[model samples]
Target chain A: MNPTYFLLLIYIIVCTLIITYWAAKHSGTTKQYYIASGTLTGYQNGMAISGDFISAASFLGVVGMIALRGYDGFLYSIGFLVSYNVVLFLVSEPVHRLGKFSLGDVVCSRFPGQKMRLIMAICTFIISLLYMIPQLVASGFLLRLLLDLNYSVSVLLIGTIMTIYVVVGGMIATSWVQIIKTVLLMSGTFLLTLIVLSNFNWDLTLFLNKVEEGTPLGEQFFLPGHLFNIPIEFLSLQLSLVLGTAGLPHILMRLFTVRNTYEVRKSLISATWIIGLFYFMTLILGFGTVALLGYEALIAKDPTGNLAAPLLAKVVGGDFLLAFVSAVAFTTIVAVVSGLAISATIAFSHDIFFHILKKGKTTEREQVRSARITAFIIGLLSTLFALRLESINVTSLVSMTFTVAASSVFPVLVLTIYWKRFTSVGAITAIVSGILASFIFVVLGPYVMNPSDGLFKTEAIFSLYNPGIVTIPIGFLGGILGSLLSKRIKQKETDFNSFYIKAQSGYSSRGES
Target chain B: MEEKLLNYIYRKRKRLFIILIFALLFYFFLPLSLIFIPEIMNKPSFLFNLPWAWVYAILQFPMTWLFCSIYHRKAKKDEQELDAIKGEDVN
Candidate 1:
C-alpha cells in the first residue's frame, strides 16, 4: 500500500537472504552451527547477545512505556540491564561450564535421568514459550500497523522465514543476524530521538513550558502521574522490572556464547553504558509521545496503551519513519523468536534427546538434525500459543515471564554457587516450587485484578511488577529443605570440593585429568 | 578450617563478584539516567540528552567481553576440578 511498507518487506527479504547465504557458507560442522563452535570473540557475541536480548518489547515496547509511564517504564530498562551483573555474578560461569550446550544441558548434567532433562526443557519451553508469545504478537501488530497486513499473514511470514534461518544456519546464523538487527535497531531509535529533540528549543524550561500549557491538567511531560500511578504502583513496578531482568532466558543463555570470565565482567560494564543511555532515550520517547498524541489519543489508539511508541513515531517522524519503526518492531520479533527457538532446540536436542535418550550415541549430524527439527516444532507451538492466548500488554507479559524465570531458575543457581551443603533434592524442589508458584501467580494471582481503574485489572496481592519478594525466598527454602530431607551424598560432596577448586582455577582442562 | 573456607569464598568468588558488578551496574543506572534526564529538564541536558538506545546498542560490545572473560575463567576452574575429582559422568 505504501513505499514504507514495501521497503520493510524488502528489508525482511534482504535479512533472510543474508542469513541463508551465511548459513550455507558456515554450515560446516554441527558444533559450529549449534554453539558457533564457541569461537566468537566476546565483542562479536556481545552485540549478538544484546540484539537477541533487547527484543521488540525492549526496543519498541519499553521506550513506549517510558513515553507513556515515565519513570515506571525506565524501571524495566534498569531491571533488565542490572541483571547482567546477576547473570555474570551467579549464573554465567556455572551455566557455561556445567553443560555442553543449553540450560537443559547444565541442569540435567547434574541430575539422575531423562526425567530431569525433560523437566528442565519443559520449564525452558514454558518460560521460553511465554517469553516468545509477545515477540510474535508484536510482529503481527507492527506489520498490521505498517503494511496494513492481516495478523496471520504477518505471523506466518515471520514463522516461515525464521524457521529457514535456523534450519539452515543454526546458532551462527542466528547470532550474526542478531548483530545486524542490533545495528539497525540502535541507528533507527537514535535518528528518531534526534529528530524529536530538534523540534524542542533544545532547552529544558521551554520544552516543559510548551508541554504544560498544551497538555491536560497535571498531564505535563516528565511530571508525575502521566503513565503510571505513583507509590504502590511505582514500587511494585520497579521490583518487577529489576527481578524480571535477572530471569529472562535469552539474556542468561548469552553467557554461554562467550570465551571467558574476564570477558563476562568487561562486557557487562560496557553493556551498562549502552543500557543506561538507552533507557534515558526511552523517557524522551514517552514525553514525545505525550506531547504529540496526548493521553486521550494514546488511550483511543490502543486501550492497553501498548501502541503509544509506534503512534508517536507517526507524530514526529512522518509516515515513512512510522513504517520504518514498525518494520524494526516486526524484525525485532523475528530475531528474538529465532534465537529462542535455537536455544530451546539446543537444550532439547543435546541435553535430552542425544544425551539421555540416545545414550550419547547420537552423531553430530543427527544432533544438528534434531536441533533443526526441535526449532521447527517450537516455532509452530509458539504460533499456536499466539493463536490461543488472549492478547496481553507486551510490558506485563515480559514481567510475568521474568518473574517466573527469576523465581524458578535464579534460586537454584545462586545457592549452588555459594552453599556447599545444597543437595540435588534442593535443586529439584526449588525448581519445581518456583515454577509452580509463579505459574499460579501469573495465571490466577490478584495482581491482574482491579480493572475498574485502568483498561485492565492488574492489582494482584503482589503488584505484577516484581514477585521476587515472595518467589525467591520460597525457592531458597525449597532447596534447603530438600537438601535436609535427602541423605547427604557424602563422597561426591567431598570430591566436589576439589571439583570446586578446579572450576575456579580457569586452566582445568589442561593438566589434572 | 572454617576460617579458610570463609576466606576462600570471600577472597575469591565474593570479592571478585562484588568488584565486577559495580562495573556492570552501569548498564541500568546510566541508560536510566539518559532517559531520566529528559524528564527532569525541559531541553534534555548536556551529554545527558544523548539518545540512549543507540549508545547501549553500541556499548554491548564491551559487556560481551566482561561476561565471557568472567565465565571462561570460572568455568575453566570448575571444569578442571570436576574432571580431576572424577565422579560418574551422569550424562
Candidate 2:
C-alpha cells in the first residue's frame, strides 16, 4: 500500500468529518439544513457553486478526453463554461426570489398546488440521481486503481461517507466541503500547470510542437472530427451542455444560499470567473499530458483517459505529486456527491414529504428527520446503481444527464418565468414529455444499445448519442401545446401579473395593473 | 406612476433579451464555424502561429468573463434604478 496516498486520503476525510460535526450543531432548523439559512457571502457561495459544479468528470475525465481526443475534447469544457451565461441571464435572480429551499418552491411559486410540487420533486430526484451516479462511478474507478479495492466496495465506501455528511450535517456541511474542495482543486491544478510550463522552459511554440508530435493525429490534432464523425452529434452535444447548467437541480438550489439579487449577480460573476479560469488551466494541463507523457503512454495506462492528469503528475513530479492530484480528485468526487445527495434529500423531504404528503404541517424537527432519512435512501440507491456502471466511461453518462436536464427542467423553468401564457398543465406536460423523450432516446441510442460494448447486442435505434436537438424542441412544444389546449377551457387564470412583477423586481405592489 | 414602472420593466426585459440573443449568437459561432467553414478555421494565423479555430475557442474564455462582468455591472445599476423609481412613487 502507498503510504502517502493513504495519508492524504485520510487527511481529507478527517477534515470533512470535522466540518460535518460543526455543521450539525447549526443545522437544527429546516432552513439551516436545506440552505444554511442563506448566510453565505457572494464570493463564498460562488466558490461553493464552482465546487458543486466541477466533479471528477471535469477534473479527471475532461483532461484525459482532451489529451486523447485533442480539440474535440476541449469543446466539452467550453460547453460547460458557456452554460453559466444561460443561468445568469435567464434564471438566477428569479430563482433566488422565488425558491426558498428547492426547485419545487420556484415552480410552485407560480402554479401553487400539490400536483406542481410532486412534478418538480420527481424531476429533481431523477436529475440529482442521474448526476450523482457519475460521481460515484468515477470514484469507484479511482479507488480501485489506487488502493486495489473492489469497485463495488469503493462505491459503497464513498456512498456511506456522502450519506453521513448530508444526513448529519445537511447543506451547511455540503457547502463547506464543496468550498474547501474548490480551494484544493484550483491550487492543485494551478500548481500542476506551473510544473508543466516549467518543464518546457515556459516556451509556447516548442510546447505546441511537442503536443502535435506526441499524438498520433499529428497536425490534425488541432482540428475537430476526432471524437465525433457526424456534425449533428457535435452540435447536439454542444446544445445540451450549453443549456444544461441552467436546468441542473443542484445548481439551481445553490441560488437560495445567498441573500439578495445583488449577491446573486456576484455569485454568478464569481462562479463564471473561477469556472472560466479552471477550464483554461485544464486546457494547458491537457496539452501538457500529451507533450510530456505522449498519447500512447496515456492510452496504455488508461484507455478511457481518466488517469491522464494523475499520470502526467507522476511523470513530472514523481509519486508525491501523483498522490496529491489523486487525493484532490477523490475530494472532488466526495464534494459533488454530497451536494447532489443534499439536493435530492431536500427534494424528497421538503417537496414531497412536507408539501404533498404532510400538507406543510410538519414540525421542523420532523422535517429534518425526514430529510436525513431521505439522504440515506438516496445514497444507498445511487451506490447500487453505480456498482453496475463500473465498466462505463465517466464522461458518457455526463452528457445524458445534461440532455435530460436541458430537455426537461430548462424549458419548464423558462416558460414559467418568462412566458406569461404558460399554465400548470403546460408545465406538467413539458416535464413528463421531456423526461420520457430523453430517457427513451438514451436507451435506444448507441450509448446503451451498441453492438460491441453496449448493454445490448443490437444496433442503436436512435443514432445520435446526444439527442438534444430533437428532445429539447419536443419539450418546448409540449409545454406550448398543452398551454394552448388548456386555454380554450377558460380555466381559472393564475395571477401572472403579480407573479411576473415579483419575479422581475422582487416586489409585488397592488397598484401595478 | 404604475404605468411608468411597467414601461421600465418592459424596457429592461427587451434589453436583456437583446443581450441574450447576441451572447447566444456569439457562443454558437464556434461549433458552426467548425462545421461550415473548416478551411478558414484551420488556417494558421499570425499570433502564436496557431490555427484560427484554436484562437476562436480560446477567446470564448475572455468572452464569458466579459459578458458576465458587463451583466453584473448593468444588473446592479438596474436594481438601484428600480429602487429609485419605487422611492419616487412613494414620495
Candidate 3:
C-alpha cells in the first residue's frame, strides 16, 4: 500500500470513528435513530442536507463528466441544483411539519391505513436500495483504486463501515458524518479551484482558450448535444433530475430533522447556496482538469471521467492533495451510503414492522433494535449486489435511482400534499404502478438492453434511457384515476382540512400531542 | 379565525404557485429554447472563447440561488403576515 494512502485512510477512519462514538449516545430512541430527535438547527441541518445531496457521484463523477463531456456535465449539475427548488417550494415545509420519521410518515398522516403505509414503505425501500447500490459501488471502486484492494473486499469494507455507523450511531451519526464530509469536500474543491486558477494566473479566459487548444473537439466542447443530442432524451433526464430529488427518501428524511417550516426554508436556502457554490467550484475544477491533465490523458486515466478530479488534484498539488481528495471522496461515499441505509431501515422498522405489521403497538426499544438489524441486512445485501455491478458506470446507476424516485414517489407525495381528494387507494395505485412502469422501462431501455452488452442482446424497445418523461405522467394519472374510481372515504375531508391547516401554517403535529 | 386563516392560506398558495411556475419556466427556458432555436446554441459571445451554451450553463448556478432566495423571502413574508393575524385574534 502507498504510505500516503495508508496514512490518509487511517486519519479518516480515526476521525469518523470518533464522531460515531460521540453520536452513539444519542441513538437510544427511535426518534433519535431516525431524525436526531428533531434537534438540528437550520445551519447544521443545511450542511447535512447539502452533504446528503452532494454525493460522491456529484463531486467526483460530475467533475469527471464535465472534464470529458464539456457543457453537458454542467447541465447535470444545474439539474441537481435547481431540483432543490422543487423540494423547497413544494415538499420541504409540508414534509417537515407532517413527517415524524420518513416519507411514509407524511403519507400515513393523511391516509392513516396499514396498506398505504406498507406501499409507501416499499416504495421508500426500493428507492433507497436503488440509490444505495450506486453509492456502495462507487465506494468499492474508490477503495479498489486508492487502496489497491480487491473490488469485493472494498465493497464489503464499505458495507461494514456503513452498517456500523447506522446501527450504532443512527441518524445523528449519519448527519454528523455527512456534515463533516461536506465541509471537507467543499474546502477540498475550493482549494483545488484556487490552485487551478493560480496555475493560469487567475485568468479564466486564458484557461478556457487553453482547454480548447489542441483538443480534438475544439470549439465543439463548449456546445450542447455532444453527449445527449436528442432533445427528448435531454428533456426526460432534466425532468427526472429536477423532480426526482424531492422524492429521494434520504433527502426527504433530512427535512424532518429541522424544527419548523421556517427552518425548512432556511435549511433549504442555505443548502442551495452551499451546493450552488460547490457546483461552481466543480466547473472550475472540471475545466482545470482538461487544461492541466489534457482530455485524452483524463480519458486514459478513467473512461467515465470519475477520476478527473482526483487526477487533477494529484497533478496540481502532488501526492498529499491526491490522498486528501481520495480520502474525502471515500468519506463522502460512506456518509451517503449510511444515509441510504438508515432511510431503508426506517422504512422497514417505522413503516412496515412497527406500523403496518404491529399496528403501531411496538415499543420504542423494539423499533430501534429492528432498525439496527435491518440496516445490517440491507448493508450486506447491497454490498453483495454492488460486487456484481462493479463494471457499470456509477453515475448512470445513480441516475436510475432518480428515475424511479421521480416516477413513483414524486407524484404521490405531490398529490398527497396538494390534492385533497387523494385517497389511500390513489396513493397505493400511484406508487405501485409508478414503480412498475419505471422499473420495466429501465430494464427495457437502452441502458440495460443495448445490442452490444445488454442482457437481452437486442435493440432496446424503450429508446429513452430515462423513463421519467413517460412514467411521471402515468403516475399522476394513476392517482387521479384511482381516486376518481374509488369509493369516498368519509373522513378524508376532515383529514385534509387538518393537514392543510398544519401544512400551510407552521403548526407542529407534535404540539397537539 | 378559521375562515381568515383559510383565506390567507388560499391567497398564499396561489402566489406560491405562480412564483414556482415562473422559476421552473425560467430554469427550463434555456434547454427548451435551445431545442426550438438550434442556431443560437452555438452562437459565440464575448465570454472568452466560450459559446452561448457555456455562459448559460455557468449562469444556472447563480440563477438557481436567486430563485430560491426569492421564494424564501416570499414564503417568510407570508408566514409573518399570518402570524400577525393570529396575534390580532389573540388580542
**Prediction 2: B-chain TM-score:** 0.89
Native-structure RMSD, model 3:
1.8
- For residue A494, give model 3's deviation from the true position in Å: 4.5
- Judging by TM-score, tell me the better candidate of 2 and 3: 2
Q: Pick by DockQ: which candidate is best?
A: 3
Which consecutive 10 residues in model 3 chain B have the weakest lDDT in total?
A: B49-58
Candidate 3 local lDDT, A1-513, one digit each (tens): 779988988888788888888888888999888899888988899999988888888888889888888888888888998999899888888887778888888887888777777888888998898889878887888778766888898898888898888888999999999999889999999999999999999887889888887256787888877788889999999999899998899999998888777787888888998999999899889889988999989888778888989999999999999989988888888888888898999999898888877888988898888888988888888888898888875655677789889888999999998998887888888888788888889888887888887767899999998878998998899888888878565534335776887777755334441
What is the descending DockQ order?
Answer: 3, 2, 1
| Residue-by-residue lDDT tens digits, candidate 2, A1-513 | 589988998999999999999999999999999999999899999999999999888998789999998888898889999999899999999899888999999998888888889999999999998889988987987888866678888898899899989999999999999999999999999999999999889999889999999999998888777887688999998999999999999999999999898888888889998998899999899999999999999899899898999999999989999999988988888889999999999999999999989998989999999998889888888988898877875555777789889999999999999998898999999999898999899889998898998889899999999999989998999999999898766544458877887788886676531
Q: Supply the global lDDT for candidate 3.
A: 0.85
Tell me what TM-score chain B of candidate 3 gets against the true chain B: 0.85
Individual DockQ of the candidates?
Answer: 0.11, 0.76, 0.77
lDDT of model 3, residue B63: 80
- lDDT per prediction? 0.64, 0.89, 0.85
* Runs with alpha carbons beyond 4 Å of true place in candidate 1: A108-113, A217-237, A390-396, A447-466, A488-494, A507-513, B1-10, B17-91
